[model samples]
Target: MPPTSVAAPPGAVTAAERSLAPDLARGVMLLVIAVVHAHILHTLAHGGAAPSGVADTVTTVVVLAFGEGRGYPMFAALFGYGLASVYARRTARGDTWPATRSLIRRRGRWLFVFGILHTLLLFFGDILAVYGLIALLFAGMLVRSDRRLLVWGAVWAVAGTGVYALVNNLLVADVEGATQVLAHPLTDIATRAMTWPAMAPLLLITSVFPFLVGVWAARRDVLTAPERNRALLARTAAVGIPVGVVGGLPYALVSAGVWAAGPGTATATGWVFMLTGYAGGFGYAALIALVAARMGARRGPVATALAACGERSMTSYLLQSVAWIVLFAPYMLDLAVRVNGTAAVAMGVGVWAATVVLADVLRRAGIRGPAESALRRLTYGPRHSARGAAAGQPAARR
Candidate 1:
């Protein structure tokens, strides 16, 4: 006979109940995120320029091939996974879809507000607002059938590619000139604010497809059932990563000056590279899931620390931007010109290391990250929490 299962109260997942794969993936990817954002921010701060030498060329190629388009998609996928997981939990707790959707929408609203503030205050490259906006824009669609989800994902990908190609073609000449304003402390903020409107659509175009795929994965409980899906994960990792790299090679070449970048070149080739991010993103995540499956449920300092960082990813993500503003913004340290790509990457690593340590300390103290706690409080009011606890509701099985 199969063993009987018990559910925990809504939103009360214990440490043991959480899957290690998702958390580990998030934690590791944050470093990738840091480095990628730092690179772009640095380039924008100084104005874009082609890499000059073999060493710089190699570095730029490596980053473009493996890091550039990959990080954000992976992060967005994880976001979808998390959102679906939460929705599953709420439904399993006997909460009506209306109630659950209401709470999630509330959370999404806060996320948008947070994103706006983060962008205005620190970095124009902020993605939180994009994610927030995505949630609000697509809330109703999330509950669509898996087949429909796949269709929508495909539609988004195709449409996004066309849109990016058009936009890139138009913006090719302006890219370098626009970024030059960042060189001035007084003009940087105004430049960023002005440019943000244009960035919003591109953000959606780049992120929506992967976000939907993540939602699909969550529906299948892919990460949660990694062991059972090892073959699938292996296949995906093997095929996706290589194909993604191949697709991104042109961008790497352009960045390295091996292939010259011009209006025609960027317009024709840029979208090809950008669109490949989806594959790389999914591949990276699958590879991580495969690794986590092998890791089992082992507990140690490294694992704990990584998991903690993942759990508090929102704070860590924002903190990375904060570090960038402090170190690179002209109004602050104004080190953009001083720091080369390699040096900026090193700085990003240092910042990521700091966040990992902070996360560990908070974990040990049994304290939720400030942003996470606030988000939780905002999403689920005190009254609902009390009701769930008093009812002794079982947790979601997945």
Candidate 2:
């Protein structure tokens, strides 16, 4: 449970429960994703050669090491955490449950639309539509008992990842026959948009398990009271971080040609990737939640800022697309080659910091961030309008 002083009094949002760590982490991760894509777009535009420099080398190594498989996991897990939160809040209100299925379906639709536009106009590498689909699919698990939710969620996720990993392992393992084997579908927009076959497994590996794990954590009040779960978290990271480092690192490097191997070896290494992801992914989520619980942004500028951003996460996500388009659009300044690997990473880090500052400033002004305000209106507007209309009806005389 949350600290006694910080816990809500049987209702409503609480000041103490707001922590911006996840938002900042999420922003940072998205920024990294942007930078990486910028580099890849440059590569695609210029036949796989980024500008050579010390900065490029460091960026390449760091991106290869830390940027490959981690960010998506974190984002997906956070999404799950959000799901758990919404479900809990709805169930607690004793009000009619929202049409969650319809809600998620609409969200998925928006994601698909947004993702298609993003892929075509800007970057071909996109995950939004698929992530949205997976979220809708996973919504059914919200009401399950904790154990069954965790276990079955894990089963579905692992099975999905295993099948896709098999495909990736077989297709990606070969260097000599790579061109002849198969391209990453469109190697561009078409693949990322509505390629349901490819996306099904990708979603399972990339987002689903972490999401369920997040739901599990929320169930236990793990974030609200992390000190109570420190030992579990420490043990988790101890096991997970190393596995992620030792096992997952190789596959990424192999893909980069550091230790390219056969299909069998690639298949073996892919297991390591998934294992470390589950282990380390769980560890990271728990650790962050615990960190938030203990050293919360309870009553200060930081807390205020993060809470605003968290409330507006969907908005912020969309805003990121806008920000990137403005920054990278060829017609804007034709900066396709100007931003290199290292600079892109730096920009990512910087953008995240800017977002935090922006969040805080928006909070102080009593103005919602553009994204937050939009989502708020979108989410609650219709229901509120309906309620208002009903409340004005004349009472019946008995």
* TM-score, prediction 2: 0.74
lDDT of 2 by residue, 78-123 (tens): 7677667766776776534446555555555666665656555444
> lDDT value for candidate 2?
0.55
Question: For model 1, which pairs clash?
Answer: 7-394, 7-395, 8-394, 8-395
- Provide the RMSD of all predictions against the true structure, rounded to 1 decimal: 4.0, 7.6
Error (Å) of candidate 1 at residue 205 is: 2.2
Using all chains and alpha carbons, the TM-scores for the candidates as numbered come to 0.90, 0.74
- Reference-based lDDT, residue 284, model 1: 87
lDDT of 1 by residue, 45-120 (tens): 5567776667767777878888887888898888788788878887877888887777667878989888877777
Q: Which ten residues in a row have the lowest lDDT in candidate 2?
A: 389-398
